[model samples]
Target chain A: MSRVRVHNFSVSLDGYGTGEGQSMEAPFGHAGERLHSWFFETRTFHQMQGRPGGGTGADDALASAWGPGIGAEIMGRNKFGPQRGPWQDEEWKGWWGPDPVFRTPVFVLTHHPRPSVEMAGGTTFHFVDATPQEVLRMAREAAGDRDVRIGGGPSTIRQFLAADLIDHLHVVLVPIVLGRGERLWDGLEELEARFPSVESVTTPSGVTHLTFARP
Target chain B: MSRVRVHNFSVSLDGYGTGEGQSMEAPFGHAGERLHSWFFETRTFHQMQGRPGGGTGADDALASAWGPGIGAEIMGRNKFGPQRGPWQDEEWKGWWGPDPVFRTPVFVLTHHPRPSVEMAGGTTFHFVDATPQEVLRMAREAAGDRDVRIGGGPSTIRQFLAADLIDHLHVVLVPIVLGRGERLWDGLEELEARFPSVESVTTPSGVTHLTFARP
Candidate 1:
């Protein structure tokens, strides 16, 4: 069955999915690339950048799962770009150049909706203003036989989690304490009960990979 | 050299040390015993209650290190009891009953300073309003040749961590999410940089033990 999975979602030790002060320059804010440094070092991530010979250990194994089996993605507006409020102009395609990594029917949740734009590598950006459930219904339809991925900016993930829609979640606990940022676990009371099968594995990079899956 | 260490500090997957709504009845608030259920199963914790024959594995080994080689403990006012603000009366010794743990000088950080109350088993509760450095100075002096422990209620630990006083920290990541509570990692920006030697171990109880030691 197709599932709603969150893969390679990195959070600080303090449960912050991203750091504060997210801008066009600093997409992850002061957290910068520290939260995703582990992923950057992985062989899978290197392959995405058209680079060869990266670490092929546990980190790569998990990083490699991001694209496979994912038909569509539901991402917050922040993940698409740092442009908040109404779009200043449609010129801001995304943080990624013409060829974005998603390469799927990516639904961007925003208050100000816009027309869908198709990018290179089979990636299409669809803007919608709706609740998580409503957007998820659309994403599920777009996903069809494949699974829908909840690409997050913390608040987005929290909403889906609060709605009990996520079936599989892969969270990487980065060693750094972000101190102040958008926290992902807010209002997720008694989260352990929802996911019975939880496993943790520590890679050589000193980050713990926690996977929570519903039975 | 005597060290300042934190052992067996339990936190939820969301990085909450304890849940919200802490009162006299709920020492750990709504978190209850869920955060510490793993420790309770350990032989060291069972032995604390005068019980016997508990598991002697990794969890037990880590739990057993709570007391030995520690001469003094510096804890936040919340950890002692749920009585916030000024001391209503000097009668509340602690929640640990007559035979409380920590057979040494235990300094409780509180604005309303009360006279020292010596409890059973050589545990002396000394209330004082001082900074982490000031309290640590007194604890180190009282400890003599032994080490001091920075006992916590999240906020207290964050203070010590901000001051860069703690040399060793052992944080257990419980798989639960309290949603609302006092977080331990607040204001501790880029904490991983301070602790160079970090390690993680997953036990049978489905909790990952993360140890960070300053070089």
Candidate 2:
């Protein structure tokens, strides 16, 4: 059966998934950008950017799994950008340019309203204003039997995990610490206890990749 | 021998360590808060804050490594908070408040000059205007055979890695793609290829932990 999953999220040593104060200028934050250095140098990343003769290996394999054939994505408005206090307008597509990195249809959870954004790739952005189950249903329809990925910012992932909607989760561990910032998994002990098994691999770049599944 | 190390700096899957525009209110930026969620709940973090009974097993062990060290600490001026050209005075301490996180003598790498900020604890923030090697020499003196840690933003760690000054590195990968922003390992293919040995572990919160060492 197709499942909903959260894949390849990178985090810091201090438990901060990111650093404080992100903006279009600095994206991750001052100290947060060091998280995904492993993936950037991968051959897959180079290939995606249309660069020639990049790489192919375990790192490339991991990068290739990042995107491709994933029918749909679900996330919160915060993941889209830093806008708060009601949707200002659709002018802010995202930090990404006209076309986002994801080529699949994306569902963003928000209390506000916005139209769908069609990018150069096969990707489209859809705004969902409902409960986790409702969004999951919509994403499943959009995804068919392929699989639905819960692309994140934290709150969105937490809500789905809280609802037991995710089937598999792949977390990539980057080594660093932000002394302060928002946290992922701050209080999810009850939810995590339900997972039955996990698989792990470590990248040469110091990224420990983990895949957790529930029976 | 006590070696210098850089561990667990989390960046967004997007390439940004921290997000763009940094401000006092939204220090990490937009959804960047999701990046470091793991640390806030770690026992290591709580203990640093003088709170008791607030960490998970793996989380506590990692958090404990963050503070209460007699060794010297290193940081970029930006971590001392925002910078405007060179240092005009010695008054600016840090964003961490009176007690500050580091209780030992700290070194701030800057192109400017300023006197050290001595705190109640053994902490004293000193601004250094020299190469990393020079800073290392002074830090070793202050550390006195204890370990020296590279408290960083991406640039600082990259410099250390490029110079091969770090002997040990740890990474914690959370899952998320910033899709835009600064990159941690923007140009680190050679460094990654050199440090090939790696080890991994995972926590209940879906964070994959990794440690890399250069023998």
The candidate that achieves the highest TM-score relative to the unseen native structure:
1
lDDT of 1 at A142: 93
Query: lDDT (CA) for every model shown?
Result: 0.89, 0.70
Docking class of predicted structure 1: medium
TM-score of chain A of each: 0.97, 0.89
lDDT of 1 by residue, A87-164 (tens): 898898888788888889999999999999999998999999999999999998998899999999899999999999
Interface RMSD of 1: 1.3
Indicate the docking level reached by candidate 2. Answer: incorrect
Q: Mark the 10 consecutive residues where model 1 chain B has the least summed lDDT.
A: B86-95
- How high is the DockQ of candidate 2? 0.07
Which candidate number maximizes lDDT? 1
Instruction: Quote the true-contact fraction of every model.
Output: 0.76, 0.11
Error of 2 at A174 (Å): 11
